[model samples]
Target: MPTRALCWFRRDLRLDDHAPLSQALINHDEIHCVFVFDTTILDALPRQDRRVEFIWHAVAELKETLRQQGSDLIVEHGDPATLIPRLAHRLGAHAVYCAEDYEPAARQRDTRVAETLKQAGIAFHALKDQVIFAKDEILTAAGRPYTVFTPYKNAWLARLHPRDYATWESKTLVSRLARHDDTLVMPSLDQLGFGDTDLCTLRLPLGTSGAETLLKDFLERMDDYAQTRDFPGIKGVSYLSPHLRFGTLSIRRLVKHALEHGGDGASTWLSELIWREFYQQLLWHFPHAATTSFKPEYRDLAFENDTARFEAWREGATGYPIVDAAMRQLKRSGWMHNRLRMIVASFLVKDLLIDWRWGERHFAELLLDFDLAANNGGWQWAASTGCDAQPYFRIFNPVTQSERFDPEGHFIRRYVPELATLDKRAIHAPWKAKVLPAGFTLGRDYPFPIVDHAAQREKALALFGKREG
Candidate 1:
């Protein structure tokens, strides 16, 4: 057993159900907890990034929780590849442990850190903490990685045991954490070269307490999730994606609840969680999908990459009410309803014929809950270039999606307030409304549709066909 170990928190921010933290506690006599605001990643982001703000507050809360238990987090700002090994060496820790990160860059950085630690005769360990099933944990009967989701989910469900979702209760051993001076202080957001975001106004509570609050609320609404999940205007889905992304909530706790409840709502919610896991495994197995389409045949697919249309889409001036409203939601709140995400993604790829990478990168910059694997999977799915993607011919009609999912335009009105006075029918497609709302004029109050959906649908189909054929 190691005499001293450093527990490095990354994506898994909480104190509970954490394997690395628990392993450190079980194997070492003294544990030093640290979180690095990795400058390598932060240096490229805009100072006003919501993700940075969320992480800053979340880590702050984690530190406070530790302090209450006679331990404090060592918060540092530097590149993890360099800083982690140096910190471990300085502290004379026998080993360094961290939550496993599977993204390409993170994987590379972890490898470098591990090598550096090895050079100093210190061991490095990474454990599965964030996901219920990781790597090839849920493989097919043939012992191959499952590419498609339903089969993967079926295997996942079959293989899942009580042990899979068991809690680690790492905090029960919190006494083992290395004690720190009361004077030790964490850096402020300004000190980290980041500014404030609208996270508070958006009511995105930070940290473990916030995640518990969301989980409680979501359980009450879980019964309606299956029926209501696709409706943008309704409060149908659990708004816990950010918490899940940052590991504020344990996958075990969530899955155990759903499996035990055994209802359509819980079951459906579980499937969504499964979808998150599926994307993760896909990225783990096919890291190239991070930057290119999963299907190699579609890798060089021609896209117009229309700059003007993409700019309009980004600015929420697409003239398609649903797409515009969704874009507005993304810009304002750093989140878009899941249904809206699909609709807007289709509009960007099929209608504007823009490269899906553009929208994926845009979302990466804006979403508070952005996960590279999930974002890439979602964008590729919409563009019909990923595993189990939408049929190439089945392009989403933005107006119809608006009518079906947001008929009352309540969601639209909230984001596109300019369309508030228009009748619900007109709100979705103002140009086609027999009589425009009394005060509104096309191209003045709102811009005209950038492109005809039908024409663009044909163009997109032909473009993809040319490449795929």
Candidate 2:
């Protein structure tokens, strides 16, 4: 009759370097690991969600891993507040352990689960695992969370220690996993009310294996990351955002690898990770940023919500090839290059005079790597509505962006097939081609520019001006 403990798995999916899992193995002789599909979240998602498919595949892999260890993952599809406490009571476990989540909905869910566990006389323990430093860890001298990124990044670098990069050894404690008389059955995606998503067909190979594959591939090209990351046509960027979002890879190991072997590429990549942490902390300190701008000054900025323009943008019919290509890529794959994300977001808020929140919500629904903090921070940054944001007047010229980043138009051609035949010089602005290539018409083949970029820039400036004055 060893003391029983339930380790609740959330975003930190892997068994390695998991604080809650490690602690469970250390303290409890018999540890039962469980994952709830979380209906509260799933019910709100679209039917063909790739993110959900990714999660389903990841969970299946996790169960297989546990089975190989002579144990099994107890999978449930319901609200954790009800399911966790009920399962703990059924197992007669004394405590439940998990990693902390900072998102508003997740925070609320955890609080509810904690209260239910408390009433049931079971201890609920949560540990920091997702991030190296979180909450108020790198606050200003006056004890406030820093609004700007540079100072916060400097403090984060200064605070880094060897111990922080060390992995928590859960492999040594594998024998502690709970063995039940009856093995628990895991549910299928259909049972959870989710249909087969595109992710399944893509065969992205979820869980630890997928993370490792992407990591190894990225390491091979890491030295040239800075040179290649900006160009969407090339494999310049590491396609690890989805893995990071799902916690398939350990952040400590990523940082350690970059620091030891990555040179200048590692330096730039590490700064990007720090930016991620900064956004997470920003959300923690200012949850209001989810609904409104971070800089209160830009809250009242006017947006001319033209649904026609937004539809054009979403359908990848925007005459600006780079912006259109990025949007199209997002539609096809749940992932987008970081550079493209910035470009598309800037086009939405600055060029179209659309509200940043609208674009933010759309991305949240579509992006597999959509974390609230990063998504919101990115949208506001593009719209010049956040602290340390780009100036409102410095709107991106989509043609120039295409010329500079996708010089050969290879990326644009891949996604926007209508522009495939056009040469490099004309691909950026197909609408302005002197001779309309046979069967290529602005309204017929590819839609015309939704709104004139130059005219809209002036309109956006005036809108911000009115708000400031």
Candidate 3:
């Protein structure tokens, strides 16, 4: 009897540099790859979800890659916890292997899968692949998770070894993959109860090949990342986020590039990567933070929770140029600039006095690169409700933020074309413009300011200040 194993692909989508899959290939005589669409999650998403389409494209490529290797990927639509064990038994596999997922929901799913696998006398292995350091791997000397980022980052950097980022080799062992004669058919998006989204129309690339293309492009501009990353107008930042999100690109490959380059730009980029791990660890240690404020006092902050303003914010008709541009960019592209993410989040929570969860949930629905940890961490940081968050009093003045970061209004004009003719000075706040472009009328062509920032800032301050600490 052959020592067979099932290599379950989830967040870690690609075959190359895959840790658990590589480990399985190294140890087992025959390895079968599988990916479950996980209807439990998909059923909750919108019909025309970009993420579903993106995953569909990636999965198709993955299946083809395995087929080219004389192997096959069993793509199924159902709960992975149930599907995995059934497939393991059907394939007569001795074990199942996959990368560890840190999100609370994923942890629960994996736990159930592990219990079922154990009942069937099969081994289950979850290896770390996504991050350089996972939960409790980079903790402080006191044996506690560091909530503060700088110290946590320093600890992470201090503990780092070259071995940590080394690529896991599996391609050389492709012959170990289980060769099956059965014809494998991948299901269409419609068949899976999902409509095709405009994911192809966007610039975002899919799968490992696409990730490689993006990385090659980003490497050229990496040296200037520190100087240019904040500006929304120019091609400053690496757009490899979606690839990173789907595990099309290995975090190790990216970290290696950042370290080998050795500059402020690379260092800054690396810190951002570390921040990702920080949030992951935080989420693991404090799952409650996912649904409520990390700081208990601010959990019940008196937010106005104005639905009308939120709707306006969502539609990008808020009459604040930068905020509107960022929101519209997200609506149209399914991606938003990092700086703009902060600005709009602040505007949504502080300026509009809505709950941070509102903006976080909205981002989760729209963002192609949305990760639970990053999105939640970012929203809480903007709203001053999470660990190491910005001070509650520090509200972003949208007009000034626009003037400073998008001084030329290049980004604003790209999405909010109504303000294209306005001068750089006036483009940041078209409602306050002394003169309007011919045929354009405030509140008619463009909306008047939905809520006064100055007035709302005080309300926001009062909202947070009045919280019973």
Best by TM-score: 3
For each candidate in the order shown, give its overall lDDT on alpha carbons: 0.91, 0.88, 0.92
Q: Please count the clashing residue pairs in each candidate, in the order shown.
A: 0, 0, 0
Residues 1-469 of candidate 1: C-alpha lDDT, one tens digit per residue = 4499999999988998888999999999899999999999999998888899889888999999888889899999999898899999999999999988889999999999999999999999999988889998988879888888899899988989999999887766888998987657899999999888778888877889999999999888888899999998889999999999999988889999998888899999999999999999999988988888888888887789989989999999999999999999899999989999999999999999999999999999999899999899999999999998987789999999999999899999999999999988989998898988677888999999999999999999998888777
Clashing pairs in 2: none
User: Per-residue lDDT tens digits of candidate 3, residues 1-469?
Assistant: 6699999999888988899999999989999999999999999998999988988888998999999999989999999989999999998999999999999999999999999999999999999999999988877788999999999999999989999999988888899998889888889999999887888888677888898989999999999999999999999999989889999989999999999998999999999999999999999999998999999999777788889999999999999999999999999989999999999999998999999999999999999999999999999999999999999999999999999999999999999998788889889988787988888888888899999999999988888888733
Higher TM-score: candidate 1 or 2? 1
Q: Give candidate 2 regions above 4 Å deviation.
A: none
Ranked by lDDT, the better of candidates 1 and 3 is: 3
The reply for model 1, stretches above 4 Å from the true place, is: none
Candidate 3 lDDT for residue 151: 99
TM-score of 1: 0.98
Tally clashes: model 1.
0
